[model samples]
Target: MSAPAVGKRQDRSGPGTSRLLAVHLRIADVLLRLVQLHALWLGWTLRGGLVLGVFPATAAVAAIARRDALGRTAEGSWGELRRDFARHWRGQFRHANALGWILAAAGALILIEERVMRAAGDGAIGVFVAGVLWMLGAGVAALGVLVWPLAAHFDARPLAVIRGAVVLLLGRPLAALAPLGAAAALAAAYYLVPGLIPAFGVAGPLWLVTAVLLRGGALPAAPAAAPEPR
Candidate 1:
């Protein structure tokens, strides 16, 4: 009787140990994926020469992250993911750059406005104008934060992508917070660790955005078809 009881206990322990090991393996797998995705993002960004590369690289990562969040690519191997990401980056390069540069120009305009406001000196009217400019800057940043994910998930023109982002910002404002918070947290972490910037920095926030949008029903029922440059 004692021997059988010992065997039963061992069997129970075996399953528990297996479960724990499985959990650890799953975590390791996820971390490895993030690292690989980050590497791809960095490589592609540098390939584009940073200025021109950043947006398309971002779109590629966003697309991959969206697929992963939807479980469409959950079982995809790293090679498959890399291939898909490259396709996205190349296909969307022109459109992504157009979208990105437009936002960049807007950001520059906002900065110019801020400088002008500062030159106006500290007065009641100047203070009021400064507050309005700050709000405008925040709105532009929010649009930017939402736009790449929209572009990745939608096969639309840059203008349409901007409109979609606007609709999402107006309609599901609360849902937007998840990705923004993720971005803020990642920034804080990178500030502290620095090394993580190259590993999980961009991929981490984009993945969170993709996941948040998917869970909140912000994405279409079906993934957008691969877009072609027009």
Candidate 2:
């Protein structure tokens, strides 16, 4: 009787341990996903125009937002980050809002261009141009949202934002493409099976990484300049 009971106890214990481990992993994964989602959304939401004039400040604020989302302290160099944001905040905010107008116009143009191009029978070239314009609109809108917290924290000037936008456009095309592709793919997938509404929850983080990388700052550190002869 004792041996039979002992074996039953061991068998039950194995499943219990497995269940505990599985639950812990699910919880951990949820937490990590939450963190990444927030960070990525912050990056995606940052508008190109707003982020343009205030990249450094926006980056700092986005970092803080990421920390908050993760339930972590803004530790280690946080003070410096705050100060850096403060240095250019007022101007950044002004320009950030101003850039909103540009985004709106771009969106309108993308719509009109696509419609006109398709109607005019411009062929593949027209479709390509329409797609490009649409992409630009996406880039602008996504950047704004991704960098919102940063804009709120470290507003900057218009020219500055333009400079940043140019760098992103000319230098890091793939970064910009990632969020757009993700958004398109997600939308397509959602349409294919409307039952998967839960998947949209992941959109935030996907956009964030894309937005940041597109803005041309997330690359590995550049080599230090060679020193001149003493």
Candidate 3:
């Protein structure tokens, strides 16, 4: 009889050892996902070539992460990651960047107002400016939390995504706010360890939003995939 092929090895370990190996692999998968997510986010943010591709790139990763979390998609290998990124980057590029620019412009306006309010200092006008600033800031934050998830799971115009996020936040304040708070905490962690952004920063926020929204029934059962980063 021919000898067993050298490359066709079979496991001879006991059942307990196989189970232990499975657990170790699961842990490694989780770690790898985090690292991949961070790298995706960091690469797009830094080297987003032409038309500010970071926005769509980040949104694509969020979509992939959501699918993986829900078991709709498999745990991604590097090739899978690349394919998903390319698919989403092409599909979502225009809409994602459009929304991003709009948000950036709004934020810039708010910052200018904030500076003006500080210059005015201590009066009725100051109080009004502060209040306006607070409202605007909160509005932006609320929108930020919902937009990317909407992009991942819906088929709609960019304006519709914005509108839907507003409606969802208003209708389900408690559910939305909890995840938002978690996202904030994760962001704080990233700030303290900026180095981790290239290996884990984006995963925490993406996972929190995707998992919470799915659990809370904030998202539809079937994802539509209309269009951005959260």
Q: Which candidate has the highest lDDT of all? A: 1
* TM-score, structure 3 vs. true: 0.79
Best by TM-score: 1
Task: Compose the digit string of candidate 2's lDDT tens values, residues 83-193.
Answer: 433443333444544655555566687778778888888678887887887787666666554334333322344445454555654576675556445666766776798
CA error at residue 53 for candidate 1, angstroms: 1.3
Q: How does each model score on TM-score?
A: 0.87, 0.42, 0.79
TM-score of 2: 0.42
Ranking by lDDT: 1, 3, 2
Candidate 3 residue lDDT tens string, 53-109? 778766777777667656776555687776666777667777788876777777788
In candidate 1, list every pair of residues with a backbone clash: none
RMSD to the hidden true structure, all candidates: 2.6, 9.9, 7.5
**Model 1: CA > 4 A from native:** 1-16, 74-80, 221-230
lDDT of each: 0.83, 0.50, 0.74
lDDT of candidate model 2 versus the reference = 0.50
lDDT of 1 by residue, 1-230 (tens): 89999999999999999999999997887678789889999999999999989999988888887777777665767787777878889988999899999888988998898889899799998889889989888888888888888887778899898888888888887777777776778778889999887788688878877777777777774764745333
Q: Tell me the deviation in Å of residue 96 in model 3.
A: 0.5
